[model samples]
Target chain A: MRIERADFPTSVTLDVRAGQPLALVGPNGAGKTTVLHAIAGHLPIMIGSIQLGDRELVELAPEARRIGVVFQDFLLFPHLTVADNVAYGLRMCGSGRKPARAATLPWLERFDLSDLAGRYPHELSGGQAQRVALARALAAEPEALLLDEPMAALDVEIRDEVRAQLADHLRDFAGPTVIVTHSAADVAALAADVVVLERGAVTQRGTWESLRAAPATPYVARLVERREE
Target chain B: MTPARRSGPAVIIWVIAALALALLVLPLLGILLSAPWPHLPALLVAPETLQALGLSLLTGVISTFCCLVLGIPLAVVLARSVGWAVVPRRLLRAAVTVPLVLPPVVGGLALLLLLGRNGILGKYLAQLGITLPFTTGAVVIAQTFVAMPFLVFAVEGALRGADRRVELAAASLGATPFQVFRTITVPLVAPGIAAGAVLCFARALGEFGATITFAGSYPGVTRTLPIASYLASQTDLNQSIALALVLLVVSVAVLLGLRDRWLPGVRG
Candidate 1:
């Protein structure tokens, strides 16, 4: 998959291979969310094209693109039960309720959320909501996955445990995964390759250790050194 | 209740709150106190009174339904027009809310000019063999014209307050825009919509000036409860007071009945 948008303060291109997790690390207002939103087709890309496999993502609607997104706050439908939330994507694709429920069972089991299937989102803890969000996104059978600040909303005490769980899920996912975050620890643990973005531009692109060793810019070097600390 | 030990700010705030509460509730209290209780039941059971009450309910419900059907889309467009040009957005908002600020009689006059027989659109409507003025339908139109802005404002506020990220997430999961609106937007703002509908109904039920101006007060036809009360005041003050008490009681009951359902935690 490739994405390019040439507008100032948001101009950047991303090349991602299938089954690889790429983390775009940047400071606040570094256009990280803008990049994720652009790839998710929420924001229009004016100057460049986004091609996923043989399909051009720029031509498709956000719904038709089949791109699963886990929002920063997890945005679980408060009105829906855990099971229904998981089943929503299937229902949207025209599956009947019975079949949608049937297909959603595996996702509940995979997230260890089988017991909470009937509970509303408000009833869940942060960690539980995060898992439910991931399950909801993956249940849609998307061509790619985009996670925005996956662990940012989690409690600090549970961050490591949930991050490990999310890493495992991303490892199991066969499609390309892109995560935008300010946390270098998130990149180290979850991402295979890191793209250092600053001021809406890619300053460095390589594995975490290579960027840590080479230190392309002061911001990238500071990020790497902070993670080591 | 002691005045001796109160702090300065607390006393000032309490005074302001008490004055505001008095401003709101004193008139209603006066009405309740002034009503002649002994003659109330006989007055309400009168044929003209019953007819007007029934007409009020019917027109109020119809107009509230119309407001819901028409106003929800208007509210959605208004809320989503945040991205639109500032001039047009403000103009639309102002236009929708014009009835809220415009005198009810003037609103009725405008509707008459637009839809009265021999009026611009009314001429065409009359040619089709449909005359609207002084009809029960005209009463409903007048009520809707004045009352819909309350609903549009309420639902628009709710829609703006709703977390739009949920809609985006639904779209990303492959739900169509209409699907997202139905399943997500509507449900998220259901409480606001319900409250708005109730408000619209209450406003429509109480509509007097517009109904009288546009539809006229004909017994068992365009005459609603307010009109009946006005007509009764000319002949029998006690009966008019009774009718006023009925309207007050019904409006209070409607609010009290649905208060907790739509506005949880609000103390009556």
Candidate 2:
């Protein structure tokens, strides 16, 4: 599917395929998140059409667009238990309290949160909260998932483990996925189809391996190299 | 245990703390110690005392209900506005804080001016066959006007400090704005709201100036415990002291009940 924003005061266009994970990588302030937000229906698109699985999604509200978002901060509800957090969408969708709660069990089991389902979000570790956040998004069964900097909030040592876990989760998820990241390690860890964004426009789009072959900018080169100084 | 030793600046700090604590506790101590030695238990069973206590509870609960319904939305509007959002929000914020700064007597006068039968807008309300001033309804209005600011301040502080990114996440999950507020925002800020409600309820329970001025002291109608105490002081000093002792007991009970909920590491 193609997404374009003509009146963003900037010409922006993005192309994503079904069952593909597109990673947006760029320097700080490059508008990578902006594009992701536009697709997720958080940002207003002056002139654009967003399609998800042959359906126009631009007209939908952020919640109604059938897209899951995992924020950088995890954004788990502090007052809610892990099970309730996962069940939030189901509950909101008018599922009764009993069934809504019961529906989250399998998701909790998949995330290894079954034992800790009763614990509040504040009681979970950072990695654990992030996983719960992912499970929460997936429990709703959205048409697409938008993950923004999944590993950024993680500490150095836990990064690899979380990244691996997130990769595995994304692999089994049956929807187009778009991940925004500032770190090249995240790009590699996700092994996403590269969509290099620069100041609200897509500079390049291709497979990660192909982008590594010929990076247009030094920023892109560093993205493939995973270097920070 | 021996009192902690202090020297110089530390001594001064301790003295200040002690003085502040004493200022708070002395009145309570005095009320307890100065109560009439005879017929105190009889006063508890008195019908007039029960009526005032019941009226106070009723008015306090009603006023607090009004505060919650009104204050939370105002807090949200004030907290979320930008530069253009500033002017109107500032005016509203200033207006809410007015009842807090203005003496309750002046607040009562203001309410009388706006809501009394001869008051502005009262003429139109009268045409609608509704008269507000000097009724039990007026007592609730007066108490709510004075108490809602406390709820607004508490809820506003909590809303400002809340991580709104969670709201954005909620939005992305297909929740309507209202749904997100009900399901997520309300639950997270519930502690602050609870604190604000406690403050409003306590203030309303003791409200006198606005209630007496606007609603007028009518036994079993507008007469709450505070107003009852004030009126009782006019003729019987010991009876007023008895009333004061009763107020102190009620406050202590409320504090004890709510303390664990508000305080960390304390079980409710």
Candidate 3:
């Protein structure tokens, strides 16, 4: 969908069909997260609009947008057990207890966190917490998914494991997913059309092949150079 | 463990700690020791004492609930910026702390001026047949007014520490702000909220000056434990001591028990 934000040029757009994974790559402080926040309705967008399929999201609140966001830090509720954390969005749906909790099991299994359901966020390893967070976000069954700096909190050791898990999860996701990250490896892993952000503006919008072959802005050039570096 | 190994400074510290402990513990010890040993069972059996105790518990719970209902949202507001402007935020914060720092009696007078039957706002409210002063409702209000800031201040501090990014994550997850508060924000800050509630509950339980001055001392109505204790102090030292002891024991026990659940990092 076309998610145009304030001060952003109207011609510059990134459109995605359902189930298409869009990996947003940019330099630090390049407003990658801000664009994702705009799409998710976390930040105010003044001039332009955001749409998911036929529904205009610019007028809606964040919840009404039904956009699932997995943050960089995972942001799992420290007070809740892993099961309850995964069951969070379901509970928000205002369902009965048995069904709501039962609905969480499939997601926990999808994340392979069935064994760690009783654990708190602080109790899990970074990778485990990340999966739980993903599972938690997905339980809502939103029209779109946004991940800001996914896998950034992981140590160098577990990043691969978490990325593979995330990749598998993203592959089966049925919604338009936007992942905001500065990491080239994660961008490649998701196999998404690249959206390069620079100072709250979209500098380059294309698949990795197009963007890498002929980089548009200095930001994309640095990204491509960093890939070589 | 050895006397000879203890240096002069160490001895001084030990003496000071012991003296401080004695100063704190003596009156409480004396209360129990000097209690009517022969009539202890009878005193416990006294119907008025039991009623006062029960009333204290009920009023404390009710007032604390009232405080929570009105205070938590106020705390969240105080903690977070509503708009970019700083002046309004400062005003709101100062307003919350006004009831906190004001002498409880003066606070009672202020509430009277605003809420008493003859007072400006109170007169308008009276036309609607609502009189707050010297009523059970007034008791709850006065206690809530004096005690609410404890909860508000505490929960605000908790809210300040709340990771906005986590809230953003929840918002991104399609949680409305209310849902975010219910599921994420409140649960994330549950311990702080709990601590605040407990502090408010204890303060409400022991609320004396404002409650008495505003609500008046009416038996089984406006007369809470502290008021009961105060009135009893005029005629019956034993009953006063008993009530005071109950408040003392309950406050300490509740605070200590709640510490584990709400204040996790507190060391002995």
Candidate 4:
């Protein structure tokens, strides 16, 4: 997919084969999230086009794009149960009660959240909430997935563990997924290709190995240094 | 509990707070003590009193429903302007709140000029064989007119405080705008909506000046509880006191029910 947002003064162009996860890593205010938002049709892109598999996404409404997003803080509906949160998108698309509830079963099992089906978002720990959020996103069966700061809100001790778990899931997903984060560790663990953004511009794009071997920008060089530390 | 040390300024602050509390409560205390206990039951059972009470309850409920239907959307519109430039939003807010600060009698007069039989749109209504002045429907309109601002402001405050990021997340999850509004927006601010509805209901129940001016006091029609109590004051002092006591008790109950919101740190 190629997405550009001139309104944000940021333009991003990328191509991804299905089942390959790309990471958009940058410093804060580098417009990593802005790029993801433009692709998801949340923020309007004034100049340039966003196309996914011959379908123009820039002009489509968010609901019409068939894209799933897991936010930085999970953004689970606090009033809904774990199962109901997962079931929400299906229900919105006109699924019956039985079908929606049934659809959440596999995702709940996949995320190891079956036992927490009846619990509210507030009752779940941060790690559990993250899993539930991912499950909620996956239940919608979108053409593409976008995750913003996937491991940012997790407890420091469990961050790597969750990252490993998420990496396992991303490997199995057969969609073009983009994860926006500032963490080099997240880029190393969860993604195959890294797109380094700096100051609302594309600084470098390559495999982590290539980017580290010949760091193109000061930001990429710093990221490699931070990753080593 | 041991007393903490208090300085002169702290002691003065405490005394002033207590005095302010008394200023609010003393009038209610007077109402409670001065109610005619001996004849309260009889006064309450009187046919006119029962009719007025039933009418008040009915109109109050219907008006509250109207406020919910109209006010919630307006509140959402107003709240959505939070990210925009301030001046136009403030102007819209002031326009909606005009009825709140405007005298109830004046509001009733304005409504009469717009909807009364001989008035502007009312002339058209008259041609269609309809007359709104001195009607039961006019009572509901007046109460809604005077009370809708309360609901709008309350829900707007709630909407303003809600997390917009969650809404963006929902939209990305393939929820249509209406679906997001129903499932996400409404539930997130459910407490505010409930509070606004309660405030709307109470205000509608107590509405007097606008209802009297627009609908006029016709027995079993526009003469609601407040109007009945007012009429009672001319003939029987005991009945009026009993009705006033009822109103006071209801107001106290509403205040207590909303204590958590107004009186912070008070756990039920």
Top model number, DockQ: 4
Which lDDT tens digits does candidate 2 get at residues B1-268? 3346535668898999999999999988887788886978877767878899999899889999999998888777767764456678678779878999899999999899998888898878999999998889999999999999889888888888778778888888889999988987877677778888888888888798988999998999988899888888998877788777787788777656654375321112
Q: Which of the predicted structures, 3 or 4, would earn the higher DockQ when compared with the native? A: 4
Of 3 and 4, the candidate ranking higher by TM-score:
4
Interface RMSD of each: 3.6, 3.2, 3.2, 4.5
Please tell me which predicted candidate would have the highest TM-score against the true structure: 4
Choose the strongest candidate by lDDT: 1
Weakest 10 consecutive residues of candidate 1 chain A by summed lDDT: A1-10
lDDT of 2 by residue, A164-213 (tens): 88889989987888888887778777855878877766788788788888
**Candidate 3 local distance difference test against the native:** 0.81
Docking class of 3: acceptable
On a 0 to 100 scale, what is the lDDT of residue B145 in model 2?
A: 92
- The docking quality of candidate 4, as DockQ, is 0.60
By summed lDDT, the worst window of 10 consecutive residues in model 2 chain A runs over A7-16
Global lDDT scores for all candidate models: 0.91, 0.84, 0.81, 0.87
Clashing pairs in 2: A63-B174
> Candidate 3's residue-wise lDDT over A92-204, tens digit each?
77877789889988888878899998887778898888888888888988777888888889999888877887899898988888888888788878857888877666777
User: Fnat of each prediction?
Assistant: 0.79, 0.72, 0.65, 0.75
Model 4 Cα lDDT, one tens digit per residue, B1-268 = 3356547668999999999999999987887788888888998888988898889889988999999999988999998877778899889888899988999999899999999988999999999999988989999999999999999999899888888688887887788898899888887777788788889989998998899999999998899889888988999888888887777677567756763463211111
TM-score of chain A, predicted model 1, versus the true chain A, to 2 decimals? 0.98
